[model samples]
Target: MLLLLCLSVLSQAAKAQETWEVFMEKIPEHLQVSLLIQDEEGQTLFSQSADKRIPSASIIKIPILIALMEKVENREITLDARYSLQATDKVGGAGELQHLPDGSGITFRYLAEEMIRISDNTATNILIRAIEMGYIQDWLKKNGYRDTQLNRLMMDFKAIEEGRQNYTSPREINDILLNLWEGKWLKEDSRAEIMHCLKGCADNSTIPSLLPAGTVVAHKTGTLDYVRGDAGIILGDKPLILSVFVENFESMEEAESAIGKIALKAFRDFGR
Candidate 1:
């Protein structure tokens, strides 16, 4: 009985790999994509270029979020710690905080929530300053995220020009989500807080786009002129951890549609 079960699982994984390979081949030749899908048990169902590092865009926020939560868990910082917004802290892009006056004060909890919920650039920068970029980088390194880095602040065009862009890989992201799912590293309450914010993520055009309505997804999205990506856990009978990144794409619509198709396919194949 044990042998039969093992064979059955291997057969299913092989079939899923074939399906994903063929499906990926159908995407346009101009788009470069790296993808990985894993079951709740951290078993890889399908993968393609999973370790290839790609520009992370706002997806780098995931590491930032985790680092912040880790600090809170260690009592190095409190969520209620307040930050006074300064003109220099504001950045123009993907956040409401940019519109608020410089004197406005906000708490760490609010900044973290806004960072994930709305992909707020200003809120992210403030948190980065509060937590200190060195600590976040050290946390990521200590946690084994080799291909993920917080190299620059959000909306920093000058850094981009200097090639100091942030980056992450599909496999690393899947691992991050899997650890979160298993309650590794952080305490349960800290994990729950992160999930709550991710569940409220405003952007759903990628991984969750093709999933059924009200499908619970705790995810983050990243976008740049040449990059589009999403990574998250899909909650259901057969929960899945999916990470898909597309680079060098000419059309955002086409790239996102490709990502959606991949996610929907994973949902159906693994949910069985």
Candidate 2:
């Protein structure tokens, strides 16, 4: 039994190494990718440019969700509190809230859900205003996410034009999922609520699309003209946490397909 156990461990280690080599060899030359995959015990299964900063796009919503939950924990805000939406908050992007009337009202919790599950730009704008971008930045720095920044509100083209875009590293993004998975800062109920919203994310064209049927992934995806990112906890026998970011890809479809292939590789090699 002891010999068999040792050999099994060796086999797993060997396979993990092979997976990394395969990834490096197969990754497209024209794209810049950053990825990190870790087991529940915090063992890094594979990593590439994990510390490199990348454009955040909608993935900024993850940190926004955390900041919002912190307010709820401190009684600064309640999930049921209705926040009025104004015409100025509406922005053109992936979401239904922008099309609604200017005077529409939605709960803090509902806006959060829409922000994550649908990457709703209007909902994100409302939440950012409610929580304040400075508070979110302070929370991030306090929580040890030095590489992730909530520098601008969603769809703020003026800010983008001035080069004040949001950013996060793969390692930093993976830390968010790791903290949620471990229930680090959030209470059990808060953690559950966040995961529930993440699991409901409607865009499955990237990582989730390539996973095996019935695989549970609580994740958020982000897309931009030149960047695609997905990060979350993969619920499986091994329960891996992953963050993948691709920038300067030739196109959105190519970027997404690359992410899909990377996810499929992780699932096939690590899933039990």
Best-matching candidate per TM-score: 1
Per-candidate TM-scores read 0.95, 0.94
Q: Tens-digit lDDT track for model 1 on 1-272?
A: 99999999889878867877888889998888899989999988888899999999888998899889988988887999788888888889899998998889898999999999889999999889878999988988998888998989998899989999899999998898899889888898999999998898989889888988878999999989888999999996899999999988878999899999999898888864
Residue 61 displacement (Å), model 2: 0.8
Candidate 2 yields a Cα-based lDDT of 0.88
- Which number leads on lDDT? 1
TM-score of candidate 1 on Cα atoms, chains taken together: 0.95
The per-model lDDT (C-alpha) reads: 0.90, 0.88
After superposition, which runs of candidate 1 have C-alpha atoms over 4 Å from their true positions? Answer: 1-4
Model 2 CA lDDT for position 125: 88
Q: How far out, in Å, is residue 173 in model 2?
A: 0.8
Pairing residues by index, what is the TM-score of model 2? 0.94
